[model samples]
Target: TAAAPPRIFPQAQHFVSKEFCQTEFGIVYPPVISVSSGELIEVETRDCFDGKIHPPPNENDNNEYNPAQALQQMKRAEFNPITGPIHVNGAAPGDILAVTLLDIRPKGVGVT
Candidate 1:
C-alpha cells in the first residue's frame, strides 16, 4: 500500500498562549511556526470568546449575569484569538498568504 498522506492542520488544534494571540488592536505577533514556500500546514484557531463559555453546570455558575451582560463584561483584549502567522521562508513583503483547507472535522455536538 502507498504511504499514508501526512495530516494537515491549517488551524490551531488547541488554545495558544496569550503571548501568541492577537489583540483587538490588530497587532500581530511573530510567527509561531515557519514553513517553506509551497508547504502545507494545519493551523488551529480559538473560538471568539476563547472558551469563556463553559458547558452546563459550570457555564452559568461562573457568571451571575445573563449572557448579554456577561458579554459586555468580557474584556475587549480577549476576543477572536487566531492560531499563527505561519511564516513562509523566503516569502517577501506584500506576498499573498494563500491557505487551502484540506478538511474540517467538528469536535463535540453543538449548534452553530
Candidate 2:
C-alpha cells in the first residue's frame, strides 16, 4: 500500500526544538516564537518522555536508564514539555486566541 502524502501548510512557519520547554511555574515565560494574528504556524513536539522512554539499540548499553528514573528526573527538571507560548503580535489581554491543528504525525512507534 502507498503511504499517504504528507499534509502541507504553505503559509505556516515551522518551528521545532527540544530546548524551549518549561515545567509548571507561577509566572509566564517569554514566547519562543512570534506570529501575526491569523498567521499559520506549525510547532513540533516530543512525547512526555522527551523521546527517552525507549530502550537503546543494544541491551548491554549502560547509557539508558529505567523509564521511571527518567520520568522522575524530567519531573524535577521539566515535565510535559510543550512546543511554545506562541505570541500573536498585537493581541492584548483578554483577547481570545484561536488554534487550529492541521495535522499530527507521530515520529516513531512506541509502547507508551
The most accurate candidate by TM-score is: 2
* lDDT against the true structure, each candidate: 0.58, 0.66
Residue-wise lDDT of candidate 1 within 10-79, one digit each (tens)? 2544222334556443324677777776665554455777766534455646645455555677898877
Question: What would you estimate as the lDDT of candidate 2?
Answer: 0.66
Query: 1-112, model 2: which lDDT tens digit per residue?
Result: 5653343555666554446666544337888887887777766576766676765446776665676676566654554667676678998989987888878777666635
RMSD of each: 7.8, 6.2
Poorest 10 consecutive residues of model 2 by lDDT? 1-10
- Where does the lowest 10-residue lDDT sum fall in candidate 1? 10-19
| Model 2: residue 34 alpha-carbon error in angstroms | 1.5
The runs of at least 3 residues in candidate 2 whose Cα sits more than 4 Å from the true structure, single-residue gaps closed, are 1-11, 14-16, 25-28, 56-65, 72-77
